[model samples]
Target: MAGGLNLGNHDIGVLAETTVPGSVRPGETISERPVDITLTMPELLRESTVTLLGGQAAEGASTDAAITLTTGGQTSTVAIPNLSSPRTDIPQQAGSPWLIPATGTVPAITVPAYAADSVALGMPKDFSIDATIHTKTTTLPAELTCGGPESLDLGSIPVSGDPVTEPTTGPTTPPTDGPTTPPTDGPTAEPTDGPTAEPTAEPTDEPGTIPVELVGSDIVAPGDTLTFSFADEWIAKKVSFELRSKPIDLGTRTVSVSGEASVRIPTDAPEGSHTVRVLSSSGELIASVPIEIEAADASDVDDTDDDYWSDDVLASAGGPGAGIAVLGGVLLLAGVAVMTLRRRAGRS
Candidate 1:
């Protein structure tokens, strides 16, 4: 927001107004931009907003002005264009102030960072916010820093707080009410003739480097192809595929000279975390890639479905209900027999 007490000369430019959340996380800043020599070194400044006020620009003009920003000891200038939308509806008469909104965006400035943190923000007031003409008072602050809520709800971020220690477990006590004396009535046991040797631990095979690189999407529906390329030992060799968790063999394919291969995820593949294992010709396991087969879409099912009385079904069943379907022929035989009897009666 910007209005004027005839700020006829003063320009705007509140320094280092706000901070954006770090690209990956949130943090804190000193925010109180002091007048002392406080442009700290070795920090990152970004996403700062500096607003200018009271400057007059011709409406609908296609002109741009220069704004300089210095940060991390490097200086850069950006062009600020005139606002396309300015409030013209404000009454230009006396007693009313001309409140023009601050418009136009400046690219992320690589300015000096504050508070000695490498990624902190700092402000250098090299530009002018005061009017060259005349104004009763400076309406805006000359310096501002990005400071606010010092923490994030993402677990706990150690912004300005001290580290906390973990709690230790307490000791447990033994049960009472039982006799403390040991029972001596048990039979003596004989020692085994052999010193029971500790069983040799089976050597576990560490995962080998999968020379393969996935070519396409790992997440796919059944019937979609999974493509990947490989190098080294697996090149130009037959590699069998396996769908882990379900133990479905996904067939085998010979790697091309280009070390690439593709396999279709069967339409019957289950919707879950599935591993596509690559194996060598001798059936040694190679690297495995994870894939997700989504549930088959019900809408993809064919609308022309067959039922019990369908032509194909009835033909396969030898007719609807089999022998019971010959009732029509039996009825025709009865009619013929009835007609013969009627003719004999007529003759009589």
Candidate 2:
């Protein structure tokens, strides 16, 4: 049988001895006595226990013993618990010895080895085992180095402790030579007489006027042509056109004495009452008209009529009857002349 046993730090040994009584011839009258065997480890003489088995008490005998071996204080004993048939081959028992402490101290049991039986028996190995212990400590001083000069000495330096002298009566006072100086009187200020007058703002003159008229009294539709005529003579420098209802400024254009200005109504203008104002360059109010710009529809038709007339024509037509009065005066003069001639003839 092939087996192994595990042992501790204590020493151990196996001893075997054979003793026979008065020996007799073999196969004749004979008496054979069983031999006693003991296993010991002297280094484990302290309080330790050991278990033994598988070895025969006598070779070629039918007797065997299993014993628990213990040692204490230079003495050891073996107690046989069971018996079995003996054999020449020894079957090893696998166990570990108890750790014994120093002579007077209690034995300290170390942690079991992590190696398997095959490793412990010197089989081929691939790995290693390691144990480690760690410790840490810290120390601090009562006072710390804050890093600066501690004290300043102004030795043998003269310092005045007396109260500062102040001027009892003077126009101006002097300053002191300490951290807080005496407040001196400021310079005397001259007084003013009365409230000053403010400049007045001049009035602005109003701008010149420009007369305008719409072509018709009806609403103007989108894509419809609008004719703007001047009621008075046109002056290019003084007149400007603006869509007052909208923020559009249709630039000014010069026209003839009896001419008209035509502009296409913008398509984006809203369909509602809109006002167009003619303003002077000086921003004076001149003339304005509220025109209705209608939306395009099937019923909307383009109508043209004599909606505007020239001021020159109107003034000429409304003048006094000069020709008729002139003819009446000539006929009266002729009647008077004929009467005078007839009287002269009668007298002749």
Candidate 3:
């Protein structure tokens, strides 16, 4: 049986489940729907927990699950079993002889992407959590059930400002590699019949500045618009842009135009380095700007401290909340009264 954590006072839970049937053959996967949860003010959730209740597999078979969350253009994934350790939170008052057995845990999760969004908003947003279940081994099918009421801790929620992107004035300085001195008319003297030295052509560099400038947060979210500004001199010279080899036309621009263009990052764009190229009407390369899309930060997202489950915090939470247990292959359910408390902070 999976045990519940001691969350001081107020509590909110969303029932988690898979979209497909519970049973699956070896190497099979089951998809899940996103779970929406509402949290109140001052409820900082530093960690989250999910319980895996009913699941049976043939002898020697192995089962596993992964959790994925997408919020604010950032995605995170968590694998189960190997990644999560056992959690034992059975209380003392239950009885001298313990009855509740240990249940599988999915480990505690802390999505910084959603955490940042939550900090920005005064209310809740649609943070999506999806589960992917997998199993392998023995010939018999495996049964895995997603236990009810996934909980988020209000006491330790990590909060951060929402990501923002802003336009920037294009760089004023030209590339340093530009030819400083003009090519000279070399070998003025005429040579005889022998092979003569050829005058070498000096490389020329483009004179214009890169049209786009990234400002505000370099942390870009999906669908976030990046504003590109063309040099005032080139706005009317018929210039275009290309990102990831895809052409982007600025359309016909008037001399009085603002010289600013915007490109929205695709929601499905892969995380890594990308380049945007500025080109002239005759297919000449003008300038290129490099951008980096961060692979979501997953550090500490799975760090569940054993100290949080110590007798101190658990005692403050007034013992464990009600949980289910299995004995001798028989299902047993018990009810316990839980006291919840709420504290409010002054409005800013």
Q: Give each model a TM-score.
A: 0.27, 0.24, 0.22
**What is the C-alpha lDDT profile of model 1 across 119-177, one tens digit per residue?**
32322221111111111222221111111112211111112232233479765976767
lDDT, candidate 2, residue 143?
9
lDDT of 2: 0.31
Distance (Å) between predicted and true CA of 207, model 1?
14
| Candidate 1 lDDT score at position 6 | 13
Maximum-TM-score candidate: 1
Summarize candidate 3's per-residue lDDT along 152-257 as a digit string, tens digits. Answer: 2222122343433345887798677868887778985766986477655874666766555554455664445556566666543445556664444422211113
Model 3 local distance difference test score: 0.34
lDDT per model vs. reference: 0.39, 0.31, 0.34
* Better structure of 2 and 3 per TM-score: 2
The TM-score-based order of candidates, best leading, equals: 1, 2, 3
Per the 3 Å backbone cut-off, how many clashing residue pairs does candidate 3 have? 10
Between the candidate structures 1 and 3, which one is better when assessed by lDDT?
Answer: 1
Q: What's the C-alpha lDDT at position 206 in model 3?
A: 65
What is the descending lDDT order? Answer: 1, 3, 2
